[model samples]
Target: MLYRPNPPISFTGAVLDRADHIRADADKLAELMNWRARLLRLDGLDPVIGDDGALVWGTLADAGEHDELVFLGLDESGRACFAPVSPANKGNPGPANPRLWGAMASLPAGDLATYGGARALVDWHARHRFCARCGYTTKLGKGGWQRKCVNMDCKAEHFPRVDPVTIMSVEWEGNLLLGRQPRFPAKRYSALAGFVEPGESIEEAVAREVHEEAGVRVRDVRYVACQPWPFPSSLMIGCHAYADDPAITIDKTELEDARWFTRDEVVYAMEALKTGAEDGAFIAPPPFAVAHHLLKWWIEQ
Candidate 1:
């Protein structure tokens, strides 16, 4: 079931949603002020983790004064939820303070989705505090979902956005094409990806990215599963394509190296990445990324 449709893909199926009942009722908004509601305290953009490698969910009593309070959807148990951004100096700490990727891998599917949504929403609020039309500050509305400008003359509203990116695995002549960027870790390589341009389709973006990076033309672009990559906020559209030509012509600007690997080599690299073996000449992206799932699908094929 490696490529199964419902395999716990990271940041995908969020159970706690904004149903019509919850949105229309005024009582639901009062849940944020309740003492029993769970709170996820973030230090700037980083989440606070406990000693057991899980995100620390605290009550109102445990959190310090926060700047913004975002209503993250309820948990699986149907409890009210909120994520408050603590001041930079007041973050909770434990034995280790891991970043988003590491914390995501250790969390359950529901928690991961909740955290991703909260992070994206919180980041949007942090970046968009003022209206573009007027120089007036905006106020949170719709239970922290919308921001409206305070100026009576220009009441501009803003909503959160998720950038779409196309990530694909290109295959030709029984070999898969992978590339490494200059900033990537030493000896690590993964699927090719690029942002979708204005008025461009996902399939076109996949083919264009493969050609632009590796000088390879791809066709038969097929849709695969997708992941919500919430680094800042992006929806990665996973795909699989077939390369028409196998010749390697690396784009020095986009990638440090681009080469084709046989199925066996890819299989070995995947195993090494899973076991954290450093001896291998090639290392795959970590399992938390959609690139890893793309590689895993190719290996299963």
Candidate 2:
């Protein structure tokens, strides 16, 4: 049996309608203050979780005074939604879940999408407290979707950014090329990935990344899928590319190792990782990752 996890966060679930025009309306803003509206509380980037392995949401009344709240659109039922960033609880006492792993633990699609979006937005806000153009403090605007510099002389607006990354599984003949970064766990290897440089198309980025990191030329760059990677906001564009040559010249500065793996090796590695086998020659990315799906697609072909 083939193992496939739920679609990556931000790609699944129904997000609220971003009612942009009504955001500035006083009456509509007041309507969000109703007690029935839901609030997602975050401590830094981590969400507050409940005992049932779900995000702990509450009404506006339950929010802390110091919380920085952002309107996160209305749900299908028309209930207003907001996400508040609170100070990190040092002790993380009682039911507070860890960031990444906790979020992946069987969360409902709606909650996962909400958490992913909130984390990205709050992260941007934290990093962009001051404007780059004039070095003035910025204020939130457009329901937290944008920030504007406070300096009257040079009021510059800033918006949240999602960095695009091209993650590709390069195949040569019957084998796939996988590499491991220095930061990766021992014996683990996955697809080659790099940030999409400005002015470069997605296909161009894939070819350049594979060549730059492994000294392998590739062609036929084909799009597979995309995932919202909210570790400081990245959109992972998955692809498959055909390698022109099998030889690999690893860039030690970028990767610890780069090599080709046979089909059987990949299949066994995936199976081992899925079954929680402690000992294995190779370990692939977990099912939640786009790399895993890329590999699965390749294996099924």
- Give the top-scoring candidate (lDDT): 2
lDDT on C-alpha atoms for all candidate structures: 0.77, 0.79
| lDDT tens per residue, model 1, 183-254 | 887999989889899989999899889988888999999887789877677899989999877987888988
Query: What is candidate 2's lDDT per residue for 119-186, written digit by digit as tens?
Result: 77777776777899989888877667888899999889899888999999999988999999887768
Candidates' TM-scores?
0.88, 0.88
lDDT of 2 at 15: 66
Alpha carbon deviation, residue 66, candidate 2 (Å): 4.3
Which stretches of model 1 miss by more than 4 angstroms?
A: 5-7, 13-15, 24-27, 61-66, 85-98, 279-281
Off by over 4 Å in 2: 1-11, 24-26, 86-99
